[model samples]
Target: MTHLTLALDAMGGDVGPCVTVPAALQALASNPGLHLLLVGDPAALHPLLAKVDSALLSRLEIVPAESVIASDARPSQAIRASRGTSMRIALELIKTGRAQACVSAGNTGALIGLAKLLLKPLEGIDRPALVTVLPHQQQGKTVVLDLGANVECDSAQLVQFAVMGSVMAEEVLSLRNPRVALLNIGEEETKGLAAIRDAAAQLKNTPSINYIGYLEGNELLTGKTDVMVCDGFVGNVTLKTMEGVVRMFLSLLKSSSTDVGRKAKQAWWLTLIGRFIQRRLAKRFGHLNPDQYNGACLLGLRGTVIKSHGAANQRAFAVAIEQAMQAVQRQLPDRIAARLKTVLPKSD
Candidate 1:
């Protein structure tokens, strides 16, 4: 029998338990063996549970506590001081083996800090990077690592991220021998920073992984690379920039108003134009569901810690729950540890 439990932060995001609860209910309907330990004020979540049917409600276990950690609180202090905070409690469940993984769309900084403290990285992992799947044109999904967790990283760290990400794509997405690429300014041999150049050399020499050389930002959506790697600062900036651009284009598309003159038969044409634009925008940027990405998986940690966007919606929360379930099913952490054990350590 599959025995997996997830600890969810019911009071983490902007929507709080409202979104989190519904997502939990959604996940439970499909996964019977999956148990949920919702951490928040019992009273608050109980009302949400009232809306769920008895069958789904029985699968959930509400672990109520008093404190709530605001996004403004210092992450380190917040995790250290707030013992009863929902995020900390969820982490505790994973640490204590009560839950297989933890998912929270809470304060990302605090989530990262708390997770690092609670679940130490694999024996030699210098950093625990966040990995998110970016939508691709033909290949379905692509894995990008170090998405804002470690701002400063060495060449060795980048290489490690590539190895871990390769394993993830193969395991989770079932991509056989996923091709790896280092994110660089250009595809040329000597076009990146010192770190990229060094990582490129390291990757060339690295065995077991299908390293496909360097890739620029434009290559990400083309499905040319299955696993893209970079330092946290660069990856984070790129992710945000792409998201911003999508939003900007979507806004422009929405604002393109057709002139329906009072003395002309352009009203029908205007309506047609409006419908076409709406469909195109929805088809293009509609996939920008943060909920679909849900929470990012904190790779390199001993256990899984999923970080959700601060302003995540119900869709995002639901997606996060599914991601958490997939992580447990794939045995990602153990696979990563085993693979890393064979890789050479970075020289000081």
Candidate 2:
């Protein structure tokens, strides 16, 4: 509900304006002080907003975009042709102080390339990371980084991720001395790749970091570690796999609910109890819904930029907008920059 402004790449995602328009309207309705700049092709976006209340429409503006970057386009190629595109214009809004933050469910690689070039990396940081919190079984959250940014990272780059992830956990998640761990094949000291082992060694010696040793894939949601670090290839696969499992589980739940409704049609009391149980189950597993965690904050940039899943639905895209809102409110980049001074080695 804070007085926040954001730019949305309305023509970026798979469903484009159909999803973004509804999400934007939902966000505006919830936050009275929020203003949004929707960047996309005006001809496509105008019809979507045709029926919105004039007063609400006053807080929203459409910045015409001439083109769009294909979801499968290479990052390098997209940058060359990025001018006037919805995603690029959204980033430009942030760079020019027209918006506090930007959210895009566009091509991940293109978004990263454009953001790093426009926003620039923070001082002492070279490789920016994609960070987002994952809900644990015990209701605690863990900050994981390098979601899909750098596929193959060296020891030094991994260490940088550790530092950034640690700062993210502490400053953004409000946790103290967040336990940091490298995602590996095993928990032993000598397990996994040389780069990961070396990063673990460096983190162990760094007094500023609370290195808790290596974390295996199965232990990610155990609530044992506060920050999980891994290369983008592994991180991306892990995140997608987990999201797929969650979606599968939720789909099964829905199917079961429908079957129950059909069987209880003749018995009103049975139907009533079934609905009650279904509601309870939904509320219990609501936090685990993959849609709620669709947005991944692209950390280490000078300004806030959130990368939503390309296939994100209306609810998922709305969640991404809210993530951008929080990142801007918390001033995540400035805080991470300040913390880097203490954690980053001086020789670099």
Candidate 3:
């Protein structure tokens, strides 16, 4: 029997339980074996469910949690100060073995801090990473790791991320011998800072991963590299910038017409060509839609903590729930743990 149970932080996002309640229903429709324990004020959730269809309401279980963490609260302070906050309670469900994974579209820092403190990292792993998927030119998507987890890392950590990310691509996406690359300024060996150089050397030496040497930032969308590894700082900036650029391009394409009367004439032409092209590109290479990859598996944690965008819409929220179900069914955390042991720097 598949013991798939999910703990959701119902009060974390902007829309709160209102959006989350409906999303839970959508997830249930898509995945029958899935079970959910919603952690938040029961009073708030009852009304939300009342608004939802009866079919979905039957699949949910509301676990009342009084305390709530404000978006601006510091992760450490909030987790410690409010024991009953939805985020903390959701973590407890995983720790207590009531749920296989926890999902929160709330504060990023709070989620990271709570995960590290509650679950701890696997042996020999120094830091956990947040990874996401991006469209590849080869008709699919590639996984990018450490998008915003450990900003500073040693050579060993970088090599480990390569191994972890590669396994994810292979196991999750079914890619064979997924090509791994160290994100660098240039493809050349001697192009980046000392940190990048040393990290590249370590990845090349690592036996478990198929390290394909340095990859420039532009190569990420080319589908040439299956997994791109970088420090959290660089990865976060790159992910956001790529998302921003895609959005800006779409905006310009939509409003290409300038004049009032002439605008109507040009709008039709732009709609027929430019608009069509922009929509396709955005679907393939853009990041404005959080629903594209709803939840980020907090890799390296003892248990899974799937993080979602705090402002996630219903679609994005549903994606997060679906991702949680997938991770549990696939044993992603256990797979990552076993894989990491192979490449962990052996103690003398």
Candidate 4:
């Protein structure tokens, strides 16, 4: 197989080169058929590149960029002033077909704006939705969409998100005839806002999707549906809340184990039991770790663009790169366009 080429915005995210450089090296080491274009200042990236193995250097190239977009910069400011920044340059590579995908941990707003501007949206897609896979109870994963890309969506936009998200689930998760649902306060047809109700009605009539009716927010991770669709505001809040709950539960588990060890220092049997329990809990909750699922894809774009969490560490950023590679290999944009052609109205 030919090597997949991906562009990395090396100066993106909180730790920038410190995290991205190592992540890039790690991704190269794991995937032999992967080529990476690291876009950032040569001066800043050279020292980090020195630490990489000589063999991997052949597959990695540094494309120097002078500027870096600030993590807090507004989307409008980034769009105007970030012309030569690493984030923008990496996206340009995708637009020009020099790279199959682009991954960045820059400001979410800025990344979304830049990607939409550079790559444009797919046909019949008025706006792109931010999508990510969340671990489900059935040992599979659920695809969630509009995770902070557009806070408000009309009925038609919600239907569009469902179509795009369903394609993502089928392509990335390999689900056949994936069940799609609209996120609502209740499962009843009468529940939720007018837009959601209207979207639900449209989805029920649409032949392309396996429309599964309304799903309450509580069913998000229960594996009740393969795809969960919502406006950005609701999706973002739900995602963050779940992340926080996972972190809190894990923290408490660790604290409890520490307390048990201290209290049972003289009792070897008790310590052993506590250690065993802690290990089991850790192993089970490992799937819920947000770091391993760091990438949020900007779906419906003509080209692939993955947004890594701004605060992502090396491991998390590596996961983001993997997400981008999956989307590229799956030809996500083309798949979405094909689905839309059959489902969307001729006027779109």
TM-score of 2: 0.95
lDDT of 3: 0.81
Residues 174-286 of candidate 4: C-alpha lDDT, one tens digit per residue: 99999999999987788989999999989989988999999887898999999999999999999999999999999999889867866965587887888888999899999
Question: What lDDT does the true structure give each of the candidates?
Answer: 0.84, 0.90, 0.81, 0.93
Clashing residue pairs found in predicted model 1:
291-316
lDDT (10s digit) by residue, model 2, range 1-348? 568899999998888999999999999998899999999999999999989998899899999999999999999999999998999999999999999999999999999999999999887787788988999987899998889999999888888888888888887789999999999999888799999989888888899889989989998888999999999999999988988898898878877865675696657777767678778888888898988888999998899999988999999999999999988888889888888888786535
**Candidate 4 at 30: error in angstroms?**
0.3
TM-score of 3: 0.89
Report how far residue 41 has shifted in candidate 3, in Å.
Answer: 1.4
- Score every model by TM-score: 0.90, 0.95, 0.89, 0.98
Question: Of 1 and 2, which scores higher on TM-score?
Answer: 2
Decreasing lDDT order of the candidates: 4, 2, 1, 3
lDDT of 1 by residue, 166-196 (tens): 9999999899989999999898997989988
lDDT at 23, model 4: 97
lDDT for model 4 = 0.93
Q: After superposing candidate 1, which stretches have Cα over 4 Å from the reference?
A: 1-3, 254-285, 346-348
Worst 10 residues of 4 by lDDT: 257-266
Off by over 4 Å in 2: 260-266, 346-348
Q: Which candidate is the best by lDDT?
A: 4
